[model samples]
Target: MSSRFVFSIMTLLMTLISTSSAQAITLRGEIQPDRYTYYLTDQYAQKLWAMNRDRNRTIRFNLPPGELVAQTDVSFAYQHPAPTAITCISSIYYNQGARANWLKVACIDNNGLEYSTHQKWPDTSIAKRVCKVGEASCDAFLTMSSDNWSGPQ
Candidate 1:
């Protein structure tokens, strides 16, 4: 091939590669024992922002399938002495809102424990939701565990 042709091809490839890869995102936030107990009312936005912004944030992850994205401001807590090390994975999936297959997200906190919850809404993409506890897992709603040293529920 000619030198000019080779140079043009290489330039095109470089441009395409650079254009395809956008800037890196950063996510950040805070979780408390009180607010974290029952899934936060703003967990959706908080997780999204953490994945898309706030550069140095921890717990970066993606959602699973059939999980609709909704906005809310409830609270939920975690059980732990926190893992010594953690991993964050992010992915996109469909959240079937009684309507259809819509894109949603799941942020898993693999910190030596499992903390899973779900929220529903009219639109999966739009931010605005009604939070529901354990509905995603097909489990009972949030409740104080029956087994407790302090007392009984």
Candidate 2:
């Protein structure tokens, strides 16, 4: 039991398993655009004024591959009457070792109930990212919100 205390407990269990496998685990959540729904392409009726009764909002997300740092904050509100055109779009799909990449961002609403913030940095090779209500075919039930996205660190 004494070989220098078993080599200092095997070097402190291999430095706590390599510092907890090089620490970095963060994933978040918070999405509400009328509980998900997406399908639009009517060429945006009159620039999307609630697209005929909030055609169902949508957002999907998945990430696993490597390096990812993203942030998004979207807030929308509308009373619709040909103003308050909310458009929030975020799409990022990726693969690097075999070459594949797609990145898109559209957070529009230059006036009326607005709050849009989007960011992406440290993209070592993403894998998933999808948000909706762009091109406006629907999603105008307004009061939309978003926040869940940390990364595939």
Candidate 3:
């Protein structure tokens, strides 16, 4: 290959790498595993939701199927366990504990283990902005369904 062609290929490779990395969780996370379980916190989940919604402006994801829970355990997972999308985020309440801060969402279990539409998990900045809207929570009005990942309403 010509030197110029090689340089162009290298540049393209770098851009792709950086773009993919930008959407990654600031904390560590794994997208694939034979089996995995994620213990997400209220703050982190909300942040992910916010990022999901932003990326998919017209598309809305399905919330965890079923009724919301009174309270749930949140993990102090500084290194985000997985790229999660709430199974149910109809309403989020803070569940504080020595271990972690949880939400009141009693939805299905998904911890970025299995593949979904959002393979490239969004960064924490997006989720942070989402929680800012409601001070305490972000799923106040936001809603999702069990209809699976969507593409344009």
Q: TM-score for all predictions? A: 0.23, 0.23, 0.22
Task: Answer with 2 or 3, whichever has the higher lDDT.
Answer: 2
Residues 33-108, model 3: lDDT tens digits: 1111233566665644444334223333444432122121232222244344332222232324424332222233
lDDT of 1 by residue, 1-153 (tens): 999999999999999888653322222222211111123235443554343333443442454433332221111112222222111222233344554333222232222222222232123342333233334432222223432447654
- Best TM-score goes to which candidate? 1
Candidate 2 deviant stretches above 4 angstroms: 1-47, 52-55, 58-76, 83-99, 112-153
lDDT of 3 at 75: 26
Best by lDDT: 2
Q: Clashing residue pairs, candidate 2?
A: 37-57
Which residue ranges in model 3 land beyond 4 Å of their true spot? Answer: 24-78, 81-153
lDDT on C-alpha atoms for all candidate structures = 0.32, 0.35, 0.34
Backbone clashes, candidate 2: 1
- Residue 41 shift from truth in candidate 2, angstroms: 15
- How far is each candidate from the true structure, as Cα RMSD in Å? 18.8, 17.3, 17.0
